[model samples]
Target: MRKIPIAETLIEKMLFIFTVAGSLVIFFVIFYIFSNGLPVLKASGLSFFTTGGWDGQFTSAWTAAPGQEIWRFGAVELIAGTLLTTGGALLVAGLLGMGCAVFLAEFCPPRLRRPVEACVRLLAGIPPVIYGVVGYTTVVPLVQSLISDQLALEMVRICVLDGTSLLAGIMVLGIMITPIFVILATDALETVPLAYKAASLALGVSHWRTIVKIMIPVARRGILAGGIMAAGMAAGEFIAMAMVAGGVAFLPNPAHGLLFFLEPVRTLAANVFINSEVLGKANMESALFACASVILFICIIFSLLAQLINRPNLKGGRSR
Candidate 1:
């Protein structure tokens, strides 16, 4: 082999160092959050995860009393809200994004595909704050109006007096994550060999049947990976969610019937954001750090899931 250039060798070493540095940074962050938060979690015990209600003043009082038990720092509602919004967002994004992806991959004319795809990608580039502003101004008012009707309000037992609610958060997050699904699913679909589609068609399968049975199955791994990523993003979304989630830490009352979505809620990420300023006050900072730890755990779980789903099979090839 020819001798490598000095510049090339130096560049390779630098890249390896940078890669190692990035990984170390991630680990350092996880360690820092856990170190700061775990003691509070231990102190709170099981109640932290099982109960709902966060009174900073009460917690501060309790913190002042050294021997008194610390209670009311629970995060059950935050967890529930995070899950509800994320699940609803996934459902909405899945349906709409997959449909758009299928249409773009199979039906759109060549000339139009570029422009349409560009539009979807543009959505991914839009800042989360913009989505928050739009949701606060438009979706909130719209939800408020729709639920304000006497018959609808009575039937659903609307809990919120105005627009900011779980429904608004879900809608905003769904819209925010739709572009992720569209882009990834479109790429996955496009990667399915044309030969697969042609073979199915040659065997007397209809175009729709070919897509449903052949192309989609072959591309499902990418679609699922995209979904996992979207879920993580939805779970950790702050600004947009905070703007529309009503900023209250309370479990959605099932007694509200179909209008439970109208109830105000606060996600774990929102909890950390809303309470971030109380760094040295009571146990608030520790509690917020705990919320952050949970969020980090959730992100880690999603990442692991994506890795498992995307792992190559024993045959040394990706699953179809």
Candidate 2:
């Protein structure tokens, strides 16, 4: 063997060191959050999640302020709110994005692809605050006008059901994440070989059937991966949702149904931002960290799910 090149060895060692360092950093961060958060969880007990009345526990301070003796850390309402907005986003984006992907993959003319692709990229690049502003002005008004007065009054017992509600947040979140789903879905579909499409068509299958039976089957993993990624994106979004969701942590009132989406709600990310700014709670720091941990847990789950669906062994609907 010839002598090893100095540049190659040096570069390899340097990259290896960098990769290990990056991994260590992420590991330490997760470890730190769990270490700090578990004690608070234990002290707070299960009631921290089950009971309502957040102010009752957080209003009192052990140091700077004094009012109550107990600390309330109930996050059930936040969990509910997060799920509602994210679920709504999934519903909206799933239909719209998947439809767009199909249109682009199977029907779009070459001349139009550039413009449409540019628009998708632009949508992805826009700042979350810009979406927040646009939703607050446009979607909010649209929703307010669409709901019947009778339904609004019925929901008022639980929340304002006004311009700023879960519906607005859902719409805003859906629009914000649509580009992500479309891009991923498009990429997934693009991976299928043209020969597969031609073969299916030659077999006397309709163009529609070829896509449904062949292309879609090969691309399902990617499509699912896109959805999971979109869910994760929706989960992490706080600014746009905070603007649209009314930033209220109230649970659905007993009279309100479990599936109520017409009322105001708050997500875990929004709650963390708001509660961290609160001055009354003595354990505010710990509680905020716990909120962060909860979000991290959700993101990790989505990441794992996306990975599981898009494995390298299943090469874009083709078997090696």
Candidate 3:
């Protein structure tokens, strides 16, 4: 091999070191959280995950006094809240973002594309706190007003006493993740071989039909990968969910039907964040670490799903 430049060799070594360091950091964090959290989960037993309420006192020691009952720490409601908000966000973001991506990639005029893409980038750059503020000030009031109508409230059997609710959290998270989907899905669509489009047009297929039938199918894997990433983001969201999720750890009653979305809730990520200040309480801190561990598990699952969806076939191409 030709002699590599000294600068190039140094840069390559630096990159290798950085990659290893980053991976080590991630592994270290996972190890730390699990090591600290698993004991608490074991001590709490099944009730830790199955029970609905969270009642913990700040005891400097690990055990309670001789006549004092142990505090209860449960995550059933938090888990439900996380699933509801994340699933709802995915539904809303997937539909809206995929539509926008398809439009931008296939139909938008060249003149408007730049501006629209810029707008998407701007939206993506906005901080989560700003989204929370907007949801608290705008969406919360809007939902409250809509549910305040006696007929509508009665029809849905609205249980939310205030505007902050699962619906509000879902809406905020949906908006937050939409830009990610739009960017990723747009890129995926744009990457479809130009020959595919040319062949479809030559076959006399309409542009829309070709897109719907050919392009989308071909790009489904990428779209799904984007969705997995968006799901991870929504699942891990804290500030925005905290602001609009009503800070209540209560499972939405499925019997309420559509009004189930009106229930106030709290998510695992938000729970960890909300309870982070109680690190001095041994059991409580361990429980929060357990919550973080659960979040980590969720992220790992999403990552694995994305990897599986993007895995290549034996034919040396991405799986369909």
For TM-score, the strongest prediction is: 1
Q: After superposition, how far is residue 33 of candidate 1 from its true place, in Å?
A: 1.0
Whole-model alpha-carbon lDDT for candidate 1: 0.84
Ten residues in a row with the worst lDDT in model 1?
A: 311-320
Q: Could you arrange the candidates by TM-score from highest to lowest?
A: 1, 3, 2
lDDT of 2 by residue, 145-191 (tens): 86778877776665677778887889999999999999988888888
How does residue 224 of candidate 1 score in lDDT?
Answer: 89
Candidate 3 Cα deviation (angstroms), residue 242: 0.9
Question: Residue 129 in model 2: shift from native, Å?
Answer: 0.7
Task: Please identify which of the two predictions, 2 or 3, would achieve the higher lDDT against the true structure.
Answer: 3
TM-score for each prediction? Answer: 0.91, 0.89, 0.90
Local error of candidate 3 at residue 261 (angstroms): 1.0
| Winner on TM-score (1 vs 3) | 1
Alpha carbon lDDT at 231, candidate 3: 96
lDDT, candidate 1, 1-320, per-residue tens: 99999999999999999999999999999999987788778888888888866755335644575655353367888999999999999999999999999999999999999999899999999999999999999999988886656744554443444778899999999999999988888888888888888999999999999988888888888888889988999999998988998887878888867668888888999878877777775466677788899899999999999888888772111322
